[model samples]
Target chain A: MSFQPVKFYQTGTFTVGNRLLPPEERSVQAQTKRFNSINSGHRACQGCGEALGARYAVDAAMEAANGQLICANATGCLEVFSTPYPETSWQVPWIHSLFGNTAAVATGIAAALKVKQLKGERRDIRVVAQGGDGGTTDIGFGCLSGMFERNDDVLYICYDNGGYMNTGIQRSSATPPAARTATTLAVGDEPGNLFGQGKFVPAIAMAHEIPYVATATVADLRDLEAKVRRAMAIRGARYLHILVPCPLGWGTASHETIRIARLAKETGIFPVFEAEHGELKSVLAIRRPLPVEDYLKPQKRYAHLFAPKARLEVIARLQQLADRNIRRYGLLEGN
Target chain B: MLKQIEGSRAVAEAVALCRPEVICAYPISPQTHIVEALGEFVKDGTLAPCEFINVESEFAAMSVAIGSSAAGARTYTATASQGLLFMAEAVYNASGLGLPIVMTVANRAIGAPINIWNDHSDALSQRDSGWLQIFAETNQEALDLHIQAFRLAEELSLPIMVCMDGFILTHAYERVDMPTQAQVDAYLPKYEPRQVLDPAEPVSIGAMVGPEAFMEVRYLAHAKQMEALKLIPGYAAEFREVFGRDSGGLTHTYKADDAETMVVAMGSLLGTIKDVIDEMRAAGHKIGVLGITLFRPFPIAQVREALHGAQRVVVLEKSLAVGLGGILATNVRMALSALPIDVYTVVAGIGGRPITMRSLHALFREAERDDIDPVTFLDLNHDVVDKQLARERSTRRSGPAAEAILRDIGVVAAKVAQEVR
Candidate 1:
């Protein structure tokens, strides 16, 4: 297929499509265009991170697979917002799996595609499963692990935005320590999220020693796309965890979604790295390290810590955790 | 075709014959064997052209299935109890998106007390989830229902669940007349997904609907389910014509003609009830039984037409609602709301408790005498509860104040410190 130029409106109104430009220049969802993978009109809140992650991840996968990709999405903010009824934002072959079973569902899709391949009809089809942190970590952990163990030909993606944003920002296992979510209230001394709880599934995936496993941040589109491309190259089970910060759930400024995600990596709160078969292969080095407080203080979800005398000691502990992560991952080399 | 097979294996054969492109699931007890069988098929190549996904939970299982189906691939999965609860959100999504993914529910009891056995409660809880729900009475039916389920689901663009009694139908070995590949192919044609992922045309599957069309969109799904009420029987008839066995589509009745009393039930217990009815019939009792095959549509019209002639209709369901009898009883009451039949409700075999022929016979005798209560807990041991309560009270007086005692252990202090800020 020939490349189409993305259409831009001469008026700075942020409308993506216009009549004058060539159809190739039009946006993916433009009326004149046909390759709109993420269809028009979804229930996603304004500037939803999960939606952005989905659009980018799915479209990139579609392009990489030569437009022969099927997406199995977990039930979360993405599924609810995208397909409300007779409408959807997905332009490719998309499915809405349950919150916990995206990985499994994608595995099934890949299997089905393989069956077609055996029949001598080469469709060049690939499968991808996407979900929010809540669905990926807590509810669907077993299925995810099973996919890893079986090495099913699927690339499962988790858009980690800290909590269960769809169901009223409840605390999920991916929720950072001391973050205020609906279930983990901002009351009591520790205030907002429990300490030393929650599992880091990326590390667990490394233990399984699958073909590929990586972590990306929405802040770095190039890195995210690169990781997705690398994941697509592999045949066995693969996982890509993307740090897509939820503005509504995290109680942060909508535009700061990318900035907060960038800060998260710089602060060593959420590391960006890749591994293969139970071994740490590489870490996306941080040029300058920032204190974890910079990443935490801006979001109202973590605002509880700033108040009640700013909890300097707690901040110190969090900083210590970040420092430990840096040293453990060798996140920075030389001064 | 006539070989000894585990109930789970029988289900796998049926699922394979349906030729689902995607199989997504998390294995929960009683249902694990079915998934295990499917897993082996993926490995051995008995089931080809399928992606067997080992999902993290039932939630993911349903979610992945929805995505695959939306992408225009036939999908299937199985779960029970906790697994079903975990995937509840995806269940609603699959139906809302109109994906037509088929899920096999190995009916098991939910937990608090942590029991694993045959019960309709798990499947019953999701009755309103918009998936076409069918309850299987035997292992053969479990296998056959799965085949019919895929056909019905795809035809209506709706997800479906083939519910069967846990270990009873899932673990038992049975001689099922499996359909040959040619026969199956002829009966169930290849699935060409209605709304599939096509980059050439690029259309979205699940999109966000605004307030303007949200209600209407849901109404469309509701209408499809209502449409299945008619569509199911038509397809079932076609299946019978090809397969040579009548499934009765929604509800199956036995010896209801010229009978004054009828026992209504669902799931594997129907087999035992039928056996007991045979004995009762030979003994010269004017009694019969009606086994409910479909739960979601409730088969309200068929149920009413069948029960209208009977004087006393006994409803046996495996799920309870505290004071309002069983779920099926409530549905039957609503169906027969306009009629004058005396409906007796019995909540039996909950938490996988076995409903034996003796127990069923005794219950039927009670139903015949008009001595049966409107709501009866079939196999509850209340004495155990009374004994446990007495023991707990005796020990409580000797126990120290809750907080003071917890503090003395030093653990409470540590917890307090963590929260103290």
Candidate 2:
């Protein structure tokens, strides 16, 4: 609750409307000269949350570094869509390495920047690596953990779209429970994704306790941009796990991508919090939280549950999980 | 200055003189001393202003190198057998991105039975990985090739892997004429990156080239390697002009001018082949040794010119292609295709098995008599191989051949397959 309600406007509203705030207090993206790091003309699907997430993240990083930013992108939707063959959407110095080594590659860039700075070749250049959930949670996990353990000067942003959306919506380790995917069908005894599997990477990232860790979503652009800027302000290893709703993978309407992401946070299923050196600092508390079904009902990944006469027990279990997260992180404390 | 130093120390000194800015390291057996020596240099302020990163895995080591190299720093790393396999994907990406990073691959046997000995299988597996592969025949050459590798890689904008025999060269101490810092500085200029990640004027590196231009992109990589074939010898000559020594070349010949038979090999094993050749020469036999320093970019023209007219060529290597014969033999035959010489493929020194000079002397005599098999597995235990084959043929489920062989040999207290990962 430390973030003040901008008093000039309806401060409690969750929309990023055009408002004339003071220059210092205004968002980085409010600037007409903000680097369109992920520019237009990319082939991302309509309402691609990852595209928005990357734009906000890299732009904020660029602003924080005073336009001295170099990005390493993994081979996922962002890389494939942004730089399709001859055309690239990135307006900054960006490199697309293998899918699973973005964190390590960014570490290398940071190492080089430090060396060059010592040699008086370059100055104040920061690095950022972006990837999908599959690359971040599974394939690139080891390298990410290595970066964290070494306190590599990088801000690794994982755009979690739940599944491997770019590669045909397969079941990644970040896929939610009781959700259908190409690999996790809706036909097993429990159906969809198994209930008791997968990992919460942001929590594990906090366990490393390097410097800074946070979770944001595309639903909250100002918050996402703020978190990115906050992370860029720090010096050591930083992790920002962003929940980006995939309209294609989650089987939701293109217009509902932001709504679904907002519902995800309001349901208390995805906690929005920040940590520094393994200590919980601040949280975006849920105001008038809704049940998990309000979030899950619109997504077609959970369609089988409703069609087969309402899997009430599974929905109840999901609600309990969200409730537990709320209690643990104090999501509804002030509200 | 000729100093009696261990081979690993020699390599470290040479690498330090080159002034690498970022050195990523991970400890795998037998390759530890080289990285450890570099770490000490970074620690004691000898190699100043270097980031000595102790990465978690070989994957991280190469990943860090890919990042640093792309960022326009002189990057270096080292690994061996299993460590090589662990970082295989990043290994390919390093070259595919065209980062001029230098790596030292201490040659070692890859596992199944899990042995950490000298072999070419590890390096040979990465032959098509777009790296300039260079082998060294002696500790002095091992030290010299690393200095040459950095120059060669940076010149071509491709990674160069400098391979020396694991325990044979890495752990062995010998008298090496170590170059002074002044001589090395005179030989190698400050690394000028061909492409870099700069904010002021940025270019997207490692772009995802689709089917429209993937083939052309790959062909250009081949063209760069072809460019290195010319640059390698020129750098060696420059190195000689500056250092006052002869160390690296595509190929080196020892008395092969009028020989009827020439033994061809790479790495420190050429030492043994040359010794055997000298002995045969003194015995009134017209035999010689042809050592291949540049294994990749195969030095086809030089290989053809040196051994084209020889009557018999013995291709001695330490790796096999499982069902097929020696990898080096296949390459040598490909190089000397026009000639109808009897190319005998000797598969030796697998899993760090000893290759004695006495055995080589006898083998060379056998080659002279034309009484050798086309493919010879040197020092193979027929009794053990036969027992394993027999058991597999007798039963549908032969429990595990490596362990069965180990049991049949009555061996205990050996390194298990624990290192397979």
What's the lDDT for all of these models?
A: 0.79, 0.90
Q: A1-335, model 1: which lDDT tens digit per residue? A: 34445554546332333444565433333334334467557777766777777676766676678778777777788888777656666767676645566676676566656656666644778888888888889877877887888888889999898888888989889988888989999998679888884589998898899989999887666567767878888899899999998889988888888778888888988888888887778888886788888898889987878875788877888888789879888888522
> For residues B1-421, could you state the per-residue lDDT of candidate 2 as single tens digits?
9999899999999999999999999999778999999999999999989999999899989999999999999999999999999999999999898999999999999998798889999999999999999998899999999999988899888998999999899999999999999988888889899889999987888777878899998999899999888898889999889888898989999989899988999999988788777788888899988899999888999988889878999999999988889899999999888788999999998888778888798888899998899999886889989988998899989998888888886734342232211
lDDT tens digits, residue span B1-421, model 1: 7768989999998888877777876768999988888888877888776777766666657766765676567788899998888778778877887878888999998876567877888898899998889999888888888888888888888889899889988999988888887777887877766676654555655555689978998898888877878987887888888888876388888998888998899988888888999999999999988888988777889898888899999998899876566788889988898788899888887876667777788888888899988888785555554555565677876443433333444574474454323
Worst 10 residues of 1 chain B by lDDT: B399-408
Chain B TM-score for the candidates in order: 0.91, 0.96
Kindly report the root-mean-square deviation of model 2 from the true structure over all alpha carbons.
3.4
Q: Is the docking of candidate 1 incorrect, acceptable, medium or high quality?
A: acceptable
lDDT of 1 at B412: 45
Considering only N, C-alpha and C atoms within 3 Å, which residue pairs clash in candidate 2?
none
The runs of at least 3 residues in candidate 2 whose Cα sits more than 4 Å from the true structure, single-residue gaps closed, are: A1-20, B411-421
